[model samples]
Target chain A: SQQGEEDPQALSIQEGENATMNCSYKTSINNLQWYRQNSGRGLVHLILIRSNEREKHSGRLRVTLDTSKKSSSLLITASRAADTASYFCATEHDTSGSRLTFGEGTQLTVNP
Target chain B: DAGITQSPRYKITETGRQVTLMCHQTWSHSYMFWYRQDLGHGLRLIYYSAAADITDKGEVPDGYVVSRSKTENFPLTLESATRSQTSVYFCASSETGNTIYFGEGSWLTVV
Candidate 1:
């Protein structure tokens, strides 16, 4: 199975703080992507980092990928109440024909 | 706006019945996918189509069927639904198989 496993199944933080989630997969990947899902809502794409790329940033979200370790991390800085959501890490393998295997996700709660 | 959409946002069906969840995308993407979300499993792929008339099974394709007769539409059908089939089904599409756009999802209940 190429499924990614996310550490810290749940995280709670106060507003203006940072939240970090990690994902690890056993298989080689072409790219790793992060998504955010609010309760009862569809997932929204956040960031994508290729295997060759070690790190990328999008607004308040920062993603790091280490192919040597087969792990990735997502960090959201200065989180707000509106940023509370479930974060998922999906891995796309080079041989998968674009199929993405997702992790169980990290449920983040930002309190005001 | 160009986006993906799904039909039957919510449905409650009985066992041994047939249910079809419809998915349509305006982007004319060649890749379309069907995934089911559960409490602890996150999202598991059920079926995927690379193009019109080209469909393949995913990790959890059993008890589910999918057809893509048109480039903009792909529908997932469940034959002889079971209680375990109850889940939130999502339809997603991608233009170049990189970034995926997902629909709101359909909540299905089989009793």
Candidate 2:
């Protein structure tokens, strides 16, 4: 079963603009991670935020976790065309032990 | 050669036929996972192994079987291929509590 659900199933934005995607999960989690897939091939790990962390950043990617709301959001600043891909949010439940349940995903298209 | 790879990038099989998708990782990560991606369904874990000789089922393990006899290899088998089993399969591995790396994935079609 899918424990996480991403909002804005699809988003189209112009290059250089900022894009934000939100995810909501059903249960308590130890950490939340975001992954990017281009052309449905392989998935690349974007970033991860622990339950105790309210926000984290890597390059242009920013991730925020709200444990109380069971939700997380990914923000990509100055989005580039190369950043166009399907982004998924996965939650590692408190007791899952290395297992991650993924959300449907958000397809972001960055237009040049 | 330094990362994860999935064999038989594409496969076509008939119902009742048995097919296998192979995954090999050179990182020697203790944790390996198998997940299938389908339209509107996202990716669902099929199975995972914490270490060689130990494996566990995930949300959707109905027609699939996984075996991890070695730390570098994990193979997923379709006992009885069916149309519903058609999907893209991804293999991933990670250190105990680190970021996971994914293979290119195998596209399987059941006719």
Candidate 3:
């Protein structure tokens, strides 16, 4: 079974707009990571926020984690046409040995 | 520099035939993983290895076999291919407690 489920299976927005995607997980985790996958390509690591950290930022990407809610959110500000891709949230369970369990993912389209 | 590479970028094989996908990394990362991506299923892990000679199953491990004889290489094999196994397969390597680096992926079709 997948450990996490991402909300808003798909999203579309105009360029320069903001896009947010949420993910909910079933169990506790040591850390959560976000990845981007362009069509017909493999996934690329975006960012990782440890369980102890509430938020993290990387350029236009912002990530927030709420341990109590067992959920996290990825925010992309000033989205561009190149930002169109599938975003996934992966959870690293404390018990697992660095094996990340991924969610279904959210497909985001940035219209130019 | 080749960070990670998967062989036979694309493959097409008949059902019931055995097929193998190769993955090689130059970083010598301690952990290696194999995942299959389907339309609605996202990326489901098939197997992972922490180091050479240590292998473990992931979320979707049925009909798949993985071996890590060397830290730089991990290969996934399908003993008997089935139509349902057609998908894009990816290989990744990572250091403990760090980000993972994925290969371009190998597209396989079981006809």
Candidate 4:
């Protein structure tokens, strides 16, 4: 079963613009992680935010987690064409050990 | 090398045939997982192993079987190939389950 559900199934933005994607999960989680996948490539881990953390940043990627709302959001500042790919949000449920359930994913297309 | 590796990166099999996708990780991570990626499904876990000789089913494990005989090897097998089983398979491993590393992937086509 899918624990996380990402909003904005698809998004198209111009280069240098900011892109934001949201993910909502069904149950309590230990942590949430974001991953990026380019065309025909394996997924690359972007960032991870623990349940206690409200927000975390890495390079141009920012991730915020709201435990109360069971939701998390990923923001990419000054998006570049290279950032175009399918972004996925995975939740590690509190009860599931070493298991991460992924969302449908958000397909972001950055036009240069 | 020092990361997760998948063998038979691409394969085509006929219906009712048995197929196996091999995964080997040199990190010696205790936790390993198998996931399948489809067009709309993104990625779904098929099986996972906490350690050698221990395996469990995940979200979609109906026609699939997984075995982890060694700490570094986790292989997924399709008992009877079906068109629905055709998808890209990814193998991942993590020492503490906090961060996972994924293999390139294996493209399996069932006809």
Q: What is each candidate's DockQ, to 2 decimals?
A: 0.62, 0.67, 0.71, 0.66
Worst window of 10 by summed lDDT in candidate 1 chain B: B93-102
Q: What's the interface RMS deviation of candidate 4?
A: 1.7
Residues A54-103 of candidate 2: C-alpha lDDT, one tens digit per residue: 99999999999999999999999999999999999998885444788899
The superposed Cα distance between candidate 1 and the true structure at residue B66, in angstroms, equals 0.7
Candidate 4, B13-37: lDDT as tens digits: 9999999999999988999999999
Alpha carbon deviation, residue B26, candidate 2 (Å)? 0.8
lDDT of 1 by residue, B71-109 (tens): 999999998999999999999998554898899999999
What's model 3's TM-score? 0.97
Shift of residue A49 alpha carbon in model 2, Å: 0.8
- Show where candidate 1 strays beyond 4 Å: none
Across all candidates, the chain A TM-score values are 0.97, 0.95, 0.97, 0.96
lDDT of each: 0.92, 0.90, 0.93, 0.91
> Tens-digit lDDT track for model 3 on B1-111?
969999989999999999999999999899999999987667888999989999999888999999999999999999999999999999999988899899999999999
Cα deviation at B68, candidate 4, in Å, is 0.9
Candidate 1: pairs in clash = none
Using Cα atoms with residue i matched to residue i, what is each candidate's TM-score against the true structure?
0.98, 0.97, 0.97, 0.97
Cα RMSD (angstroms) for every candidate in the order listed: 0.9, 1.2, 1.0, 1.1
Best by lDDT: 3
Best by TM-score: 1
Model 1 residue B36 distance off true place after TM-score fit, in angstroms: 0.2
Candidate 4's residue-wise lDDT over A43-97, tens digit each?
A: 9999989888999999999999999999999999999999999999998885444
